[model samples]
Target: MNSEQRKFEIWRHKMVARQIVARGITDPGVIAAMETVPRHLFVSEALTDSAYGDFPLPIGEAQTISQPYIIAEMTQALELTGDERVLEIGTGSGYQAAVLAEIVFRVYTIERNNILFLRTRKLFDALKYHNIVARYSDGTLGWKEEAPFDAILVTAGGTQIPQPLLDQLAVGGRLVMPVGGLCSQELVRIEKKADKITTDNLGGCRFVKLIGEHGWKE
Candidate 1:
């Protein structure tokens, strides 16, 4: 088998199947995508050994690669069908975007941190994941030019769902985000249907602050 395949097998056993999936991820597609992606590539060289570990790790610039379970859970929550255009609000490490790319038609990810934007762009290019479009910008504005997204995912914490992002959601589109201050937050799922919107609280989570216009105060 090729090295990539071997790495995938190791990831399946060591990360997804043995750790995340077994721990109740329940989404087979998410598990498969997590298994196949080489997560180590997204992390810094110093953290390579713990790449497959079931925990978050710092990825520089006061950001971190979300824990593997969180990634799987959030991706699965979107209920993707491999045909929707997904907008990811934070592209830290590009790990989440990579996972979404494997399951969606295309991904447009925005990172407010310039360093992270450049680094993630290079990583996506090197991995030949052409479907992901990475940009350095304020994620809370929801990339208005590319509105009507099939799905929108905010990876950072904010005080509330940004109105612009809500406006950008396509009719029947789903938006998943963490809302609250730095010390506490709730993971919320919002579904838009025409002019009506329904929201559900998924659970609690802690994420870096999303700083930008329409996001947290500077």
Candidate 2:
């Protein structure tokens, strides 16, 4: 392998793959996507060393790049087939969007923080991820122009599922999010089929609050 490729492999294995993926992420597609995306490039240069670690790292602006395991787990839970249009509610560092770009047909990511939105757009450009469209907006509102997404992933915590997001999900689509109060949250997977919506609690997780009209009051 070439120098850069070799370096990425080492980083993935030692910092992300072995500890994160092997522990609970069973989906091959999720594993492959995470392995190929350069997580280090998504964070600040000062925290590059911890880029591939299993835990979340600060990315400034009171945000963090979600942990690799959580990313993989959420992606796997969606049961994506690589042909669906995915909507990401939080584009903290654009790392999740980059990973989704590797597997989905198109990725529409929304970031509430303007600084993170600009920084992530630059990262997407630098990495040549043309499939991802980044926007600075309230994530809880969902992207109305890009409604009827095949899959929606929310990266923050809320007391309840945002109704706008549920409305935006196409029939037979899936939405994964962490739902509950600030200190207590459970990862939930909502599936919409025809006119009915089914909900399943995956597990508990802690995440920053999702602030918006249909989300937590801020």
Candidate 3:
């Protein structure tokens, strides 16, 4: 690799070993995806050098790209098996969706911000992340026509788990999201079984509010 590529690789290696693996994010797929995807491409050039740091960074449109550890945590909780079709809300910088695209068969991502949506779409194409199909809409509504996804990931924090999302989950599918008040939130995962849904709090997290018909009003 060239000098620039080598620099990113070193940072990514340290990031995985310390911020991810040491923190107990042991999913091989999650680790692999995080390693392979060039996160610097997702953030502004000014913040590119700090892309692999242990914190979230602004990506414009008042949204932030989640910290690497949080991304790995949420992705691990989904437990993708490579054959699954995943739905992702809040495409943001499209980094998370690219990570998922590396592990799953297909990924349907939604972003409400028009600029971010268009920008991320081009970035995904240039990166050859063809498995990621993006849409611009109210993410809380989920994708109705694409219901029954094998896994669903909501990248933004909402007051509650949007009912429409729950309704779209396939039986035996898993959904991971952050839910709580305006300033802070807790990471939560929901599993849909034969006749019941199980919920768990992965831990605490913070994200921009999810605004839409079923989410916080604009």
lDDT of 2 by residue, 136-171 (tens): 899999999989999999999999998899999999
Error of 3 at 178 (Å): 0.6
Prediction 1 global C-alpha lDDT: 0.89
User: Higher-TM-score candidate among 1 and 3?
Assistant: 3
Best by lDDT: 3
* Decoy 2 TM-score against native: 0.95
Give the lowest summed-lDDT range of ten residues in model 1: 4-13
Each prediction's whole-model lDDT (CA) = 0.89, 0.89, 0.95
Query: On residues 81-200, what C-alpha lDDT tens digit does candidate 3 reach at each position?
Result: 999999999999999999999999999999999999999999999999999999999999999998889999999889899999999999999999999999999999999999899999
**N/CA/C clash count, model 2:** 0
TM-scores, one per candidate:
0.94, 0.95, 0.99
- Top TM-score prediction, candidate number: 3
- For each of the candidates, the C-alpha root-mean-square deviation to the true structure, in angstroms, is 1.7, 1.5, 0.7
